[model samples]
Target: MSAPVVKGWCPGAHRPMMSGDGLVVRVRPRMARLTAEQVLGLCDAAQRHGNGRLDLTNRANLQLRGVSEQTHRQLLDDLANLDLLDPEPGLESRRNILVQPFYEHGDQTCRLTEILLDRLADLPELPAKFGFAIDTGSNRVLSENSADIRLETGMSGGLILRADGSQTGVCVSEERAIDAALGMARWFARHSSPELRRMRNLVRHTSLPGHWTGKPPGPLATRSEPGFTPKGPLVGAAFGQILALALDDLIRKSGARALRITPWRQILLEGGHSTPAPGFVTRPDDPLLTADACSGAPICPQAQAETQMIARQMAGRIGGSLHVSGCTKGCARQTAASVTLVGRNGRFDLVKRGRAGDEPAMRGLTPEDLLTLTDLT
Candidate 1:
C-alpha cells in the first residue's frame, strides 16, 4: 500500500480536506464546547450532509467525514446557524486553540482564550497546524496535547508563555499573557520556514530567550478517565469515532445540558447523568478506551489493512497501551505505545514501546498471528 501523506494543514469547516471516503469537514467548537441544541443539530447535520459518523480529533475538534460537494454548502449553513463556523477561512485557520475542559465560565482560562481569539488576526503568518493552548487551569491539563505556543500556569502560581519545546517559560500576569504569546508567535514566524513549521523543531537548534526559560511549569493534572465526573459523565468514543445516531440517543437519554470536547478520545456531557450507551465507553476500565486506531481500509486510502476490527480484538487482551495504525502516519495517536501494530502490505509489523513508524521487531504478521500470540512486549 502507498504510505499515507501527512497534510501540512488541518481541515476546517470553511476549508474542508478531501479523503478517500469524501470531504473531511472539521468543526472547531468555541471553547471546546457545544450547547445541547447545538450538539443535537450537529448530529442531525452529520446524518444528513455527510457520513452518519463523526470523528473527535486529538485537537479537541469535531469532524464530519464522507461529505459530498452538493451537501457541503448546506452543511456550512447549518454550522453557521449553530455558531460553530468562523466568518472566513483565514479566521478559522488561525483559531487553532485548545482549552482544558474543567474551566468555568469567566475564569482565567475563559478570559485568556477570549482575548486570544480577538488577537488571532493580529498574529503573523504561521503554519497551518500552528496552535495555542490556554492551559491556565489549576494544573497543566493540556501537557500531553499538541500546541506550538502554550499559556500554562507556573509552579510559582502565575501565567507563563512557553514555547512548545522549552523546559521553562516566562511568567506573565493576566493582562499581558496574550501579548507575551503573540510576541513568541512573531518570533516563531521569523525563525520558522516551510520545512521547519513547528515550534518544537525550531527550538531544537535556536534557543529561547533567557526570560522565557527560567520558570518551571506547574505539575500536570491527572488525565480524565471515562466515568462520572462532577461536571457530567465522561464518555469515550472508540477510535474517536462516534455514530451520529448513538450520540443523539446518548444526549437525549442522559439529559446532558451540553457537550464538552476533549483532546483525549472522550466527551464531557455537562450536567449529564450516568447511563450505559451502546457504542460509548462508560467504564473507566473499558479496554476500548485505551485502544487507539484510525479509520482504515476503504475509509482511508493509505491503509494497507482494516484496523478497527483487529484493534477491537487486541484491546483487552493486551498488556499495556496499544496503537493499531492503518499506516505509518499514526493519526489516531502521536505518542509511542507499549504495543504498536503498523499496517504494511495487508499485514502487520509490531513495534514494542515505540511509535508506528519505528522499526518493528516482527514483520509480516497476519491478524490471526496477533490474536493467538500471548506477549506483546
Candidate 2:
C-alpha cells in the first residue's frame, strides 16, 4: 500500500480529499451547531451518497466519507438545500471559524462568529488549514484545539486577540475583537510565505505585541462524557466516529432542537436534560473515549494494517491514551500518545510514550504479538 497522504490543507464539501474507499466531503456547520432538521438531512445524504460513516474531526467539522463521484453533485445540492453549503468556494474555504459550544443564542460568541463569517471575504487569502478560534465564553475551551488567531477571554475578563504561540495579546472589546483579529491575519499574510502558513510558524520569525499582559483564558470544562450540561446532554462517539444510521436514530429519539458538535468527540443535544443513547460511549472511563484510531487498511489506501479494530481491542489493555495509527503520519492524534503503534507493511512498530512518528522501541510485530507485548510491558 502507498503511504497515507497528508494534504497540508483540509477538505471541504466543494473540494474533497481522495481516500482509499472514496471521496471525503467535509461540512463545516455554522458555529458548529446543526439544527435537528439539518442533522437529519446530513445523515440522509451521508447514507445515500457516502459510506454511511460520519467522522467528527478534531476541528469540530463533520465529514461524510466514502462519497462516490457519481453522487457527489447530488450530495452537494442536498447540502445546499439544507443551508449547509457555501455558494462561493473561496469564501467557504476561508470560513474556518471554531466557536465554543456552550454559548446561548445572541451571545458574544455567536455574534462574533457571525461577524467573522461575514468578513471572511475581506481577509487576505490564507492557507486552507489556517483558522480562527472564537473562545470568548466564560472559560476557554479551544486553546488545545488548532487555531492560528484566537479571540479568547482575557485574564481581566475582557477580549484579546492572542496569537497561538504567544502568551501576550492585544486587548480589545467585543465591538473591535474582529478588527483586531483581522489585523493579526493581515499581518501574518504580509510576513508569511507559503512555507510559513500558521501563526505559530510566523511567531518563530517575528515577535507579537507584548504591550498587553492579559493572560491566556481559563481551563476547558470537562465535557467529553455522556452527561448533562447547561446547554443539554452530550453523547460521545467512539473514536470520534458515528455511524449515519446510529446518529439519525439518536437524533430522532432524543427530540433535540439542535446538535452541537464538539472537538472532543462529544455531541451536545439541545434539550431539557441528558439521556443515555445506545451504541455511544456514555461514561468517562470508557477506553474507546481515550483511544485515538484512524480508519486503516482497506478503508484507507495508505494503511498497511487495520487500526480502529485493534485500537478497540487494545484500549482496555493500555494504561493511558493510545494512538493506533495507520502509518507514521499520525493523523488521528497530533499529540504524543502514551503507547503509539505505528503501522508498517501490515506489521506494527511500537513507540512507547511518544508520537507515531517517534523512534520505535520494537518493529515488525503482528497485532496479536503487539497486544501481548503491551500487556507484559
Candidate 3:
C-alpha cells in the first residue's frame, strides 16, 4: 500500500497520483459494441508492473496500482502497444464521458458520447471532474444523470440536455445536437469559478441566460428492450488485489472484458455475448451487492475488524445496501446507504433507513439493539 496524498479541490487530486515520470494509461480495446478480452490482459499488467491492485472508479474507468519509481516508462510503452493509451496528453482527465454499455451503436446517445469527448479534449480549462453522460434510450440510464452534463431523447424524435430542471435547445440532427451540448459546457466553463468543481456547483452561483434557453423537444424517455437492463452484477473485493484476480478470471473465461469500477467499492462487468456460470452473480438482489466494508485493522491504522471478512459472513442474512466501516471516514461509498454497520473495537452497531420498497431515508438509525431487533433475515 502507498501513502495517501492529501489534495485540495482538483479532480486529479481525488485520483491516485503518478510521479512526473510515471504514466497514466488509458485503454480503448475497440469493443464499443461489447466487452472483450483486452480487459484480462490489462489486469495482468497491473499485477506485474504497477501495483498488484486495480481500482474500479465511479466513472467506469480502471486504475493500475503501485507503479514503482522504476518501470514507469516500460508501462507506457506497453500500454501504447496495446492501443490502450489515449493519444491526447493532459486531456485524459477531462474526458470524463459516460456511455450506456448496454445500448447498440449508431444511436443518438452513443453519438453524443463521442462528440462530448472530442469537444472536451480541446478545452484546457474544462474541470478534470467535468463529465457528460448519454442515457441509452433507457430508464436505467436516466439515473446516471447525476453527471455534470446529461443528454436524453425526448418522447418525440428529438434530443435535449437538461440542466437544473430547465431544458436547453432541441436538435433535429445528431451533429447539431452534440454541438449545442459542447457550447453549453464551454459557456459554463467560461463563467464558473475555479473553485466550482461541478456544473451543479456552478449553477448555484450562476443562472442560465436567456440566450441559452430554447424549446426542449419534449420529456426525455427511454424504452427498454428485452434484456437491455445493465445485467452484470456488482461484487465487492476484499482489496484491489482480490478485485484484479477475479476480474482477470472473468475476462479470460468470458472474453468479455469491459468493466465499470464504481465509487461504491464494487466492480461491474458487462456480460457481453456470454452468460456467466450458474454460480456467478449478476443481479442487484445478490448478497454480494448487499454489503460493503472498508480496508481495516493492520492495513489501516484506524480500523477495527477485517470488515470484509465479517461483512461476507453476514451478507446473505442482510438486505439492502449494507456498509461496515472501520471508522467514520467512510472511504467505501459516497452516500449513506440503506443499512450501515459501523465498528467500534470488536463490537458492531447496525443502522437502518427507508422502508423495503420506498426511497431510502436520508437519516440513518444508530442503535446496538436494532441489530437483533430487526428482521433483516
Candidate 4:
C-alpha cells in the first residue's frame, strides 16, 4: 500500500481541506462552545449540505465532512447566517485557541480568551498550527492538548504565561498576561525556522529566560466523565464522531442550552438535564471510550482498511487503550496505546504497546483473527 500523506495545516470553515468523501470544513467555536440555536443551525447545514457526521476534534472544534464543491458555497452562506463564519480567512485561521470546558462568562479563562481574540490580528506571522491554550481553571485541563503558548494558574494561585515544553512559567498579573504571552509569541516567531514550526520544538533548541522557569503550574485536572457536572449533564461520543441527527435529538431531548466540546471526546450539556438519548454514550465506563479509530476506507482515500467497525468490535476485548488507525498517519490517536492496529492492504498490522506506526509484532491479521485473538492485554 502507498504511504499516507501528512498535512501540517488544519482545516477552517473558510479554508476547508478536501477529504475522500468531500470537503472537511472545521468550525472553531469561540471559547470551545456553541449555543443551542447555533448548534441546531450547524446541524441543519451539515444534514443539508454535507455528510451528516459532525466530528468533535481533539482541539475542541467541530468539523462537517463530505461537503462537495458545489454545495460548499451554500454551506458557507448558511454558516455565515448563523454567525459561524469569519469573513476574514486569516483571522479565522489565527484564532486557534482551546479553552477548558467549564469556563463561565467573564471568568478568568473567558476574559483572557476574549483579550487574545481581540488581539489575534496583532500576532506575528507564524505557522498555521501554532495555537494557544487558556487553562486557568483551578485545575489545569489543557495540559496535554497542543499549544504554542499557555495561560494557566500557578500552584501559588497566580496567573502565569508558559511556553509549551517548559515545566515552569513566568508569573504575571491578569492585566499583563496577554502582553507576556504575545512577547513569547514574538520570541517564537523570531527563533523558529521552517523545521521548527511549533513553540515546543523551538523551546527545546533554545533556553527560555530565567524568569520564565520557576512558577509551577497548578495540578492536573481530574478526568471528566459521562454524568452530571455543575454546568449540566456530560456525554461521550465514540471515536469523537457524532451523527448530526443524533446530536439534534440529544439537544432537543436533554434541553441543553449550550454544548461544550472537550479534548477527551466528551461534551458538556450546559443547563441541560440528564435524559436518555439514543446514539449518545451516557455511561462513563463505555468500552468505546478506551478505543480510538479514524475514518477509514471509503471516507479516507489513504485508508487501507475499514477502521471504526473493527474498533467497535474489539473495544472491550482489547482490555486497555487501543488505537485502530487507517494508516501509519495515526490520525485517530497520536500517542501510545496498549494495542495499536495499523491498516495495510485491507488487513491490520498489530503493534503491542506502541503507536500505530510502530513496528508491528504481527502482520496480515484479518477481522476474524482479531475477534478471536487472546493476550491483547
Q: Which candidate is the best by lDDT?
A: 1
lDDT of 3 by residue, 51-128 (tens): 556654455556565565466567666666666665555665566666655555576666667666566555647755
Model 1 Cα lDDT, one tens digit per residue, 9-98: 898898898888999999999899999999999999999999888999999999999999899999999999999898878989999999
- Select the stronger candidate by TM-score from 1 and 3: 1
- Choose 2 or 3, whichever is better by TM-score: 2
Candidate 4 structure quality by residue, lDDT tens digits, 62-131: 9999999999999999889888888999999999999998988889999999999999999999899999
Against the hidden true structure, what lDDT does model 1 obtain? 0.92
Q: Model 4 clash pairs?
A: none
Model 1: what TM-score?
0.98
lDDT of each: 0.92, 0.86, 0.54, 0.91
- Model 1 error, position 145 (Å): 0.5
**lDDT per residue, candidate 2, 222-250, as tens digits?**
54466777778887888888999898888
TM-scores for the candidates: 0.98, 0.95, 0.70, 0.97
Residue 40 Cα positional deviation in candidate 4, in Å, after optimal superposition: 0.7
Number of clashing residue pairs in every model? 0, 0, 6, 0
Q: Tell me the deviation in Å of residue 21 in model 4.
A: 1.0
